[model samples]
Target: MNLFLILFGKIFVFLSSFLNLGSGSTWPGHIALSINKNFLKDTLTKRKFKIILVAGTNGKTTTGKLIKEILETNNNKVFHNEAGANLINGVASSIIKNSTFFGNLNFQYAIYEVDENTLPTLLKFFSSDFIICLNLFRDQLDRYGEVNIILDKWRKAFGKLKAKTTLVLNSDDPQIASLGKKSKAKVLYFGVDEMRKTELEHASDSTYCPNCGSKLLYKRVAFSHLGDWMCESCDNKRPIPNLEKLVSYPLPGLYNRYNTNAAVLVSKSLGINQYFITRVLKKFKPAFGRQEKIYINGKTLQIFLSKNPVSFNQSLMTVKGLKGKNILIALNNKIPDGRDVSWIWDVDFERFIDSFKNIFVSGDRTYDMAVRLKYSFKNSHQKLSVFENYKEALKFGLKKINRKEVLYVLPTYSAMLDLRKILTGKSIL
Candidate 1:
């Protein structure tokens, strides 16, 4: 019965792609779950696999990809939700497609990037040999309410891991480091030794300590509120760095530094050799749509997925670091890209006025975003154009840049998906 259901879901995936029903991000699992809601949990129980569960506000997908790569580099068979699918249904879709008809696995290891809210429920079903918490910020505020609420859920669900379950943490994030204090399981922390505060976005929810609830004093903020955080009233402080920037990472910004550090330490803790990790870091490209670059006609187009305030600010910082280039920003308020469009106000879009040569905007909320930018611009001469239609915006944005000149695209989740499908003539799904 389970085999038949799994096969059915696999068929749905193929047909969905063939007939263009949007590549089965939801339906295959919906159909499979209708047959067995326990399909994912049930399948995993049959195999005593080594599991790695990664959950956080950002960098979950990239970090999971790195871990999968490192494991495969060492010749380990692994399964993961690599399509940027982190929820229960998404994870189930991956499992159904990857598993044999009998719900058996060919992989020795499973690397999963579970959603922040999904972590609690998934933890009730299966356990992990290692779990990595990248960081926590208030995202989908309508959905999750507060950072502490998600943190409490994580602390509770993750607290139940077996004695051997290794919790890999970001020592720089107080919200992340606090997860280690009460754990009976082995905990490994990784962070940068020091980085000067580049651009501070006060929109971060990490201004207070998770331990004592007192204000956090950041001696240096790497990006957003992630930094060398210290609490005046409590014993909670940023963990001493176990791993720092080893090499000039392939990805941009201080955020990628944290991502690489977490991946390096997690891989090392799993007994993966330093040599393999070094090579992985050297060769790793940005996960697609995450600073993913496309070149055509001597013009480079970069995609930076900006979903939340901190990431949006960091994306701008990424643009600011590059030589002034034409930029296209697309925003949408789909369910996947949080319904609340209010976070746009949180990003310091004003900072980009001096950074880019030309700015083009598109997506569902282009007008709203244009209004936001109008209030944000500091320079009177900055060229800002708005397009409600992405095709025109893509054309206009692409045409503005010439040979060796880059075009940076900053997009919300849905906008990124839609534009990628159109740009590459391939579904980002």
Candidate 2:
């Protein structure tokens, strides 16, 4: 019966893939497999599989991809959600699609990027051997009520895990790092020691302590609220960094440094050779739209995706040091990208007031972005050009940019995909 069910599941998946339907569309296949788990228990049993789960507000995709690469470099066959389907149904689909007849997962290990809110649900399906908890930030408030809510859920779920599991946590984020204290599993942490780039003294959020009622004290801040912090009353503080040093990348920003550190720690914890980890880190390329570069018609265009205040501020900081003569920005208020659209004010656009040569704004919220730029550069030499249409905006912006000078284009999530379609003549998805 188990063999028959597995064969049926494989056939369904093969047909779905051949039909050009998304791997996520195999939900029915997963349900059928779940029903036969008991019958297939013998084939699935006696298999010691390693599992790595990554969860956070941002950087999940990049970190997950990098960790998968490092694991694969060590000759480990890893099954992962490469298509970015992180929900429960997506995980189920990936498992069913990758398994063979007789309910055997051919892969030696599994690495999944679990969504922050979906971690509790996925935890019930599979017990993770290792978990990487990245920083938490306010994102899509309509969907996720508050950062604290997610943190509380994580704490409750992690408390129920077995003691053998290992957790790799980011100490800089008070919200995320606090979860390690409750987990019965072994915990390893990574963070920056020296204070390089901290947020402004009067930044939003970062108030109230997660442990006790006392206010959290900041020794150094990286951005918004992420930094070396401690609570005086309850004695809550950032966890000690186990992977102290980090390999530097071409990407400019303190946040990228944190990301690199997190990835390095995961690689080391997985028992990967140090030599291979360093080699991969040096050769790592920025994920698409996260400082991705492209060339067209004898001109170089650098694209950076900025969806929220933290990301937008970091992207602006990255280009502030560059001697760019032309700039283009795209903003949108779509569902997946964001709906509030008011978070733009939190970004530090004042730094680019006098640096850019020409600033082009385009997207569904092009006028809103233009007004923000106008206020930022109210007394600067740079002028704002608004185009309601993305294609026209891209044409005009590219025409104004000289081939010798670099054109920096920053767009939100939806706007970035739309701009990529216009620039590359293909869909990024």
Candidate 3:
């Protein structure tokens, strides 16, 4: 029955791709799971290859790709589900796609970037050799609720982990670091070493103690709630990270630093050499739509997928650091992007809104974003423009920049896929 499901899934995936319907990353697995509840467990129960599950609200895709790059560079075979397919169905589909007709995953490593809500459930199907919980933030509030809700779920999941499993956690994130308290698994932590007095963003989550209800104080903040935090009430504090600073990082932004740290720690835990990991990272190009660069018509465009407030703020900070002049922000309130567009207001646009020379807004909620920008701009808003047509906006934004200048595009989840399809003439997951 499992073999039949795998064969059936492969055909569906092929037709989906052949017909340009979609990536077929989830539906096939959905059908398979519906047909047989234990399809994932049955297929993966005795697999020889190691399994690594990466879970968090942000950085899942990039971190998964980072781990895959490091492992594959060391000559270890690695496969991961297409980006945005972090759900159970997607995991099953990846298995089906990678498996033989008789159901075999012929790879040394399978890195699965799991959805925040899906991790607990995914663990029920199979026990991972390594589980990396990046950081928890308030994201897709309608879908995942608050950070504490996820923390509760994660604590339960971590409790189920065996001693053989290695759990990599972010020490800067209080909610994440606290998960290590009672877990039976071997816990390794990764964090940033830079410490200074930085104010928390207005929309920061997990500012309170996980142990006590008292507010957590920060000696310094990395961005949101993550940093050197301690609860004076309960005497709970940030864990001393097993790995903190890296000699080099592939991408910009402190968030990417955190992502890199998580990936490097996981690599080291897997017995990958530090020298090899550093070499691989220096040559690492970003995953698609994640500071991914593309050139056309003597013009350059770099995409920074900013789906939520925290991610948006970080992207803006990175673009500012790059001295990016042209900016395009595409906001889509689709199901994939979380229908609630109100999150845009939480983004600290006022900090870097005036830095860009030109700003273009488009996508399903063009005016909504335009309004946000209009309110954010402190000076004359002559640089801001809006377009209902995203492709036209891209064309105009590109025209505004020279070959040497990069048009940095910050887009929501679904908007990123649409913009990529427009630029590359094909969909990426």
Best by TM-score: 3
Q: Model 3 — which ten-residue stretch has the worst lDDT?
A: 194-203
- Clashing residue pairs found in predicted model 3: none
The reply for model 1, stretches above 4 Å from the true place, is 18-25, 198-200, 379-382
Candidate models: Cα lDDT each:
0.82, 0.75, 0.90
RMSD in Å for candidate 2, one decimal?
Answer: 3.3
* lDDT tens digits, residue span 291-364, model 3: 99989898999999999999999999899999998999999999989999999999999999988899999999
Model 2 misplaced stretches (Cα beyond 4 Å) = 1-47, 197-204, 380-382
lDDT of 1 by residue, 199-282 (tens): 446767777888778988888878777888889898678888778767567687778878888888878877999888878778
Estimated TM-score for each candidate:
0.95, 0.88, 0.97
Better of 1 and 2 by lDDT: 1
Candidate 3: RMSD to truth:
1.2
TM-score of 2: 0.88
Q: Where is the poorest 10-residue window by lDDT in model 1?
A: 193-202
- After TM-score superposition, the amount by which residue 140's alpha carbon in candidate 3 deviates from its true location, in angstroms, is 1.0
> What is the Cα root-mean-square deviation between model 1 and the actual structure?
1.9
Query: Which whole-number lDDT from 0 to 100 does residue 416 have in model 3?
Result: 93
Question: Candidates 1 and 2: which is better by TM-score?
Answer: 1
Kindly report which residue pairs in candidate 2 clash with one another. none
